[model samples]
Target: MATLLLTGASGLVGSRLLPRLVEAGHTVRALVRGDVTLPAGAAAVHGDLADPGSLRPAVKDVEAVVHLAALFRTTDEDAVWRANLDGTRNLLSAVQAYAPRARFVMTSTGNVYDADATRPARESDPCSPTQAYPASKVAAEALVRESGLTWSVLRLPFVYGEGDGHLASMPGLVSRFGLHPAHTYSVAHHRDVAQVVKMALAGTLDSRVVNVTDDAPITVLEMTALAGSEVEGSAEPLTDPWHGRMDGTLLRELGFSPEVPTVQAAARAGIL
Candidate 1:
């Protein structure tokens, strides 16, 4: 079994991915800030992306690097850059220096894609991200491209399902606006997200940038219907603002069919 280095093994996606990786018999070297209980058959390695030097031994002997640690916040620019961009720069440099041959798979957002096109977004579309999160991710993508190491960038859109941050937050949004989201965007399931992450590390995916999301765009109206709240007359709040549109063609070509559809999975996860 090959050794895989997981950076954010404590996060929402990482928490889920950890068990699967261990069950698959892969030796998972999980990085954590302090003392935290690790699952069976997984090794806990202490490291911090902010401290680039700390990653030396963590990256050593690892066959692959699944870098998922990023500071994501729409309002805080300084914190976002420090966590997303700077951390990425440090980690990429360390990976290049230490495990140059290891495949570096990164979790990027579809927010980096242009929203003006109106059509479903694909991997080749020019990124015109207006928000700070996607904007930094755009820069992060550039770092990976220039790292001179084998890499795969999975651009995910509205990753949801039992997570604290997602459509579950829609009820609060509805209450804030006293209505549903006037604008709708593309989305993807969380467990499916884990599969996409694995695919990036496996290197079987032909496409470098695959849009990880649902087959077709699901509207906020449908989402709010699942929200179990009351809404007024047919007055939509705002125009359909494109946060991130995902074109999952490459995912299909790679034969990726997520077991749980985003909406249904959310309901099962108690989000709905």
Candidate 2:
């Protein structure tokens, strides 16, 4: 087992992933800004990504870094940039200076893909995100790629399950984004997110940007219904059917088979 430094331990994704990393027999040091409770096996190391001075101590001697910290779903665009791009620059600099050999695994979003793609977005597709969140992620991804560290980037889709309430928010998001009911989206369960992170730490996904998603791309109509809500059905022609869909062939080629293969499967298993 390796000594790992995990950022964003109190957030939705990190909160779920931290205990899993510890349960897998790894030593985990969770980096946080203020007083916060962590999973039993993790040691808390107070630090903020915005403060470069606080990062060195947290990263020192770590064998790997799982960077799950990012800002999204906020109206403040500047805050989004600072937290996502500038903060990642700080972490990358600290790791390079303090723990030069640590493997860096950064989680990103599938929204970075362009909306008018002909098919499910691939790793090589050009990222042209117009919104602040995904734009910042694209810039941050550039930093990680150019940081000269052993790095792996996981582009996550609509993460759900484990009562995170992310799936339940689909109805609101559908109305907000003006999405057609027939439009499909790729998704990942929290369990599968941890599974892929373990694989990255094992060096199975070095020097690659991988799309981590489940086996099925679910429709917005089904997602809304599953969320215990309803949306108006649309028979109108969909303009961007593949907008949020991603190609998971790369992950499969890398020997990844999602534990929760589909949202329907998740519902059946009582995990959603």
Candidate 3:
């Protein structure tokens, strides 16, 4: 098993993925900026992504680095850029200097795709993100692609499940953005996120940017209903039907089959 360094182990996705990696028999060193509880079996290493001097020991002697740390859903654009873009640059530099041959798996977002997509977003599509969060991610992805490290970038969709409150926030997002009720969104369970990370660590997705999503793209109406909330239905003409949706064909071609293949499946399994 690989000795892995995991960033953002206290965050929504990392907190869930950390235990899975440990249970899979990998030695996990969780990098934290402050006092935070980590899952059992992970060694906590004090470090800050914003401080380059603090990252060397965290990246030293690790076989892989799982970068799940990123800033999103905040109104502070400068903070978003610093944490997402500059932070990623710092981490990449540390990895190159300390663990030059380590497998680097960075999690990006599907929000990097253009709003007026003609179809589900693909890895090959040109990212034209206008928002601060996705724009930072797009820039971060560029750094990863050119960093000369053994890397894989997973552009994730709407991540939910395991009581992360992501689905619960859907109603407010719909209300705030005026999203259409029938607008579909690609989603993945936290379990599948772990599965994809394992695959990346195993070298199934090296030197590529793959979209990690489930079998179905669910609509806002269904998502809000799953969250025990409701949004008014609309029959208005949808301008960007494919917005927030992604094509998962590349990962499928690489033999990826999500354990929780749909949101409905997750609901039925009582994991949602």
Supply the TM-score for candidate 2: 0.98
TM-scores of all predicted structures:
0.88, 0.98, 0.98
lDDT of 1: 0.76
| lDDT by residue for model 3 (1-272), tens | 99999998988899889999999999999999788887778999999999999999999989999999999888999999999999999999999999999999999999999989999999999998889999999999999999999999999999999999999999999989889999999999999999999999999999989999999999999999999998888889987899999999999999999999999999999999
Per-residue lDDT for 1-272 in model 2, tens only? Answer: 99999998888899999999999999999998888888788999989999999998899999999999999888999999999999999999999999999999999999999999999999999998999999999999999999999999999999999999988998999888787999999999999999999999999999999999999999999999999997989899999778999999999999999999999999999999
**Local accuracy by lDDT, each model:** 0.76, 0.95, 0.94
Among residues 3 or more apart in sequence or in different chains, the pairs in candidate 3 whose N, CA or C atoms overlap within 3 Å are: none
**Sliding window of 10 residues with minimal summed lDDT for model 1:** 230-239
Count of steric clashes across candidates, in order? 0, 0, 0
Q: Predict model 2's lDDT versus the native.
A: 0.95
lDDT of 3 at 5: 98
Give stretches of model 2 more than 4 Å off: none
Cα lDDT tens digits for candidate 1, 1-272: 56889988888677878888888778999988899988998899888888998988899868888888877744788888888899899988888888889888888887787757667677888887767788888998889888888888887776666654666566676676554345566777767787887777778652376778776566666766665653443564444355445777888888788666667565766753
Give the poorly placed runs of model 1, Cα more than 4 Å off.
162-165, 173-182, 230-234, 237-242, 265-272
Worst 10 residues of 3 by lDDT: 32-41
Query: Predictions ranked by lDDT, top down?
Result: 2, 3, 1
* Cα-based lDDT at residue 4, candidate 3: 91
User: What's model 1's TM-score?
Assistant: 0.88
